[model samples]
Target: MEQDVSAFLGRLAREVRPRSNQWAGLLMQRMRGELPELWEDEDLARVALSETVDHVTAFLDGLEHNRDVTRAELPPAALELARRFAEGGVPISTLLRAYRLGHVTLLELLQEEAARLTDDRQLTNDAILRLIATAFAYVDHGSEQVVTAYQEVRGRRMQRRLFLANEASRRIGTTLDTARTARELAEVGVDHFADLVTVDLLESLLRDGGPQPPTDAPLLRRIAQRSALDGSPDSPVGTGRSHTYPAESAPAEALATGRPTLLRVTTPDAPAPSTPDAPAPPAPPGPPDFGIHSVLLLPLHARGATLGLAQFARDRTASPFDDEDLLLAQEIAARAAVYIDNARRYTHEHTTALTLQRSLLPQGPVDQFAVETASRYLPSGSRAGVGGDWYDVISLSGARVALVVGDVVGRGLHAAATMGRLRTAVRAFADLDLMPDELLTHLDDVVIRLQKEEAREGAEISATCLYAVYDPATRLCSLASAGHVPPTVATPSAGSRAVDLPDLPIGPPLGLGGLPFETAQWELPEGSLLALHTDGLIQDRARDVGASLTLLSDTLAHASRSAMTPDEACERLLTRLLPERRVDDVALLVARTRALDPSHVATLHLPSDPAAVSGARRFTTETLTAWGLDELSFATELMVSELVTNAIRYGKPPVHLRLIFESTLTCEVFDTNSTAPHLRRARTFDEGGRGLLLVAQLAERWGTRHGREGKVIWAEQALAQPHLP
Candidate 1:
């Protein structure tokens, strides 16, 4: 009975072996009908046929030799097919079911072959039972091996996906720049996740933290794109190029619905659908073909808003995407979305703050007679946002110019606002012609008041200021600091040196009131360069303040020796002193000292008597005539007469009269009297106050300045042409 069954089984195997190719073809056709996903692609179909043929050949040989099929190695084709299935994300259950269907077909073929060999029912039944047992053992062993191969590849694939996700999370959004963050995501995708990756964001989101309005067609700007394959055209749109997506496109659909869309291309000629989770649509027909087989379009949605879209794609050389790939892509997109949103918000805030700070700063040339000035203001890098550093050239009375550089001790809108306020206050005090030390004292008080106001909001306000006044008449620069760096002065003859305030006290920063500020006076020569800068210019993390100061001094000395213009000197200093990535705001003000021409000024000592009034008026007329400012003679003489009379009447000892010719014709009277005359509306019968009132009415501008010796009552008349004769 064993011989008869074995002979029958051997006969069936010999008959099946020659027809194995035909049997494998029939088996693949049946499996394709039941398991469509496994045979979706031509490559997969080929792998399936090869695996089927190998299984058929091995089974027939085992039956013919009565070999122990259960202990045999799985066919190489079977193991390869299993790996392909795993990579393509086909389920193990589907593969197992296809094997079961193949087994059934094999049994039917075995019965037909057995019937062809013999007619005895018992012999046929016995041989069929033995053949069925052998087939079962073969299928069981092949299924176990195939499953092991699939599981090993699947496990490694999942681990790689996890690693990609972790890498994306760690590297994205390292800087608060929208474009950079997008590029980071693209790099991670190309390195580990996809062959081609692109990040596209709505124009509105990048411009102003606003959502794009809904439309039939969606537009997205491609901010970044990366491709793993060299010389491969990954995207039709280049970086920073904007293109509109059709309403039915996967990217548009994903953006509109704020969901992820997975697309698989089964055939080159098949009409792919644009719907989510459907087959991929053919890309626009043109040159530079993408040859893409799979794509995942995911909307970058975060914090209850959709910001943009991220696309991951694979070419024909790679496996088509599946459910597992879509899930992994979604995970990475979710993390990237948060980072992109953060960067977008930061960009908006930084832009707004910087704009406000720039607007509040002084614009255009200061055009002061005391000094020719140039300035530069630079905000900190993106990570720190905008900071509150300010510089100004304030035109003061008596041909004096006030150079100011200050820093608010924080960043963003609040600090900028504080800087604006402090700058306004300084200008106001400057107009009053207060001394540098006294002006800073008042500024300190203002800062204290600001701190008090903001304290209730749980915000503290602190600031530093350096105020310096340059007087052309005296060629003296009086400077005072409130916890700010000293200014550097470079001369034509002497090298650059930081102003020494050894005996003078550099008071505490503003907001700390009750400290008296001291002023230091330096007589800078004409053509000297004075540099007033915030601590940002001379304080860096990599270098000590002393070293930075020395560098600044050296650069300034070189600039001065080179005879560069104030503007050129400013550019040179900034280029040399500034770091590539600025961590703090920088404000630099460079001024070239200019002295009033001695030929334009006339000074005469006078006796404290009524006779001096006429002499002063005569001197004013002569000086105006000599300077070719005859047009202002009448007004200048009358104003000079009134000021000289007031000084003689209210004075004690010697008086002085001076006339200056420059932008305007000025007449000044100096006396021992310390009291300053005030402008008042004179009554009809009051002859006493009319003298000062007449002076004010005749002169374009009139004021009184007090000095250690006494007081100076001065008045200026407008000149048609301010040039010297």
Candidate 2:
């Protein structure tokens, strides 16, 4: 049976073929008779049907080729089968099976025919050609059967390729943002012989150069290249045949007319000859000979500027690109132009902001004042915005110094103006050496005056300011605050503390109507440092300002061990305090305790006793000797002796005396006397009346203070130390 079937298949190869419709009828009849009992798998049955049809079509194609060659004879049934197979939709898989079985030579003959069909020339000797290698797969190339199959498989592959190409283009666009050179951009269009040049005029060249840029002539600039026939060049780019791109060929004309242009150029140089014996030099590089006819140039535009253009050569193997592709390129160029401009503007603004901000800050140290200062102002990372916070270190007479930092209410120029006004006033007052409360009250008046001129709400200009006067000689800090953070004292032995303020805000902010601002004072001990700042240090609306202060205190506490000087400690704390997204400005000032030799100042903490008085007087005398104030020590000893004796006799316990043995001896006695102790007239006969009179006579200056806990009686005597020249 197999031999008979094979002979029949051989005869069928030499017959005429029918169309697919009649072949379908014959296959259905054959399926019913040969495979009725095996009809369980509907899916498998469909597969068999498709396979059978493929083989039948291959057999019919073979039969036609045989008729042309051998004029072979065919029996009636074989002839009918060949005709039916052609009309049927046969599967290639089944035809391949039949070829392997040696039933026919159809596969070989059809393959030969397909090979001859390779060259598709719609026109012969056509002088002009325009082809697109990519377009051929889409519209014109391949047979009906092959084209259909390609639509199913190759079409999907093309879709995926196009998607990836679009994504890559987007990424390339991102990479080209702000790119200024043609070479840099050419790396993006790696496969093309492309140059990005600036277009200044419709008929002229531009001095500046770039791939995508702004141009005044939005309609006339163009980009162009040589055709496949002409070939690009044998230069570093391997695209062989070389052609000249005349300045005239620039699509400036087409763009000026609101149209696009496509042209082709032929190169003067021919492919170099190769030797028969030697390995041929690489075929002079050139565009692949796919029968390209012309080059296409498209104009780019954005923001009413011509910008530049894109040029590409058509493929010789395919139809030339048409209006659709040109439109796509134009769209791509438009998007690219906008991106370049935005990037440039952003860079310019960023640089400008930094410059303006630095200009508004204070730069140098003031003389006579030992000041340690630092400031940190961070702008929001967002585009086009800034804030205002500033600081000052001012110098004054008598070895006095002032620290000032304040934050204006809002942002931008208004806030900056407010900051400048407030700082200037503080510096002027600092020169006056006004006490803290007096200075703040004066500042309030200035703010009120400025508010009247600006016509803005005084409430809107609200700010916090802390002023401290540091006297290096006395190691005393007379401080006052106006709605600002209080100064903190960090002692070598006592750690850190916020110095207590006994009064309400040194009167309600300067512009607000309020009376009587009181100044606060503290005996800033030797080895004690003070920290002052604005509300920006501790206040945030999201978290309580108090909590921020706690955090600050903790940071300052930890910083004490590692930092070497007041400046170093302030820097450490500032770095931690200004984290990202800081909503306000920060100013910090640190003043270390003025160094004093132990011999110059004698400290006396004595009980209110006649013996204690005597002890303090002896300490004064001995301290004077050490400080070389011996001559003055005699006067100091007598004055201190009398004060201690009076406090022991009728004054209170817990007397304190500090003998500052500088150019003079200052005898300060702190006693529990509520009464303001006085120096009365002493007649020649009254020895007790003469005690204080003797004190007044011996010292340069003497005073008494009625403090909260007790009264302090103090006197100063000239020192014996040699004067500085």
* The best candidate in terms of TM-score: 1
- What does the lDDT come to for candidate 1? 0.81
lDDT of 2 by residue, 225-258 (tens): 2232344342221222112222233443444443
lDDT of 2 at 339: 51
Ten residues in sequence with the least summed lDDT for candidate 1:
270-279
What lDDT does candidate 2 reach at residue 306? 52
lDDT of 1 by residue, 476-539 (tens): 8888899988788888877555444345467899988888998888788899988999888876
Candidate 2 Cα outliers beyond 4 Å, as residue runs? 1-350, 370-384, 412-418, 432-463, 480-483, 496-519, 533-547, 561-563, 580-586, 595-725
lDDT of each: 0.81, 0.50
What TM-score, over all chains together, does every model reach?
A: 0.82, 0.43
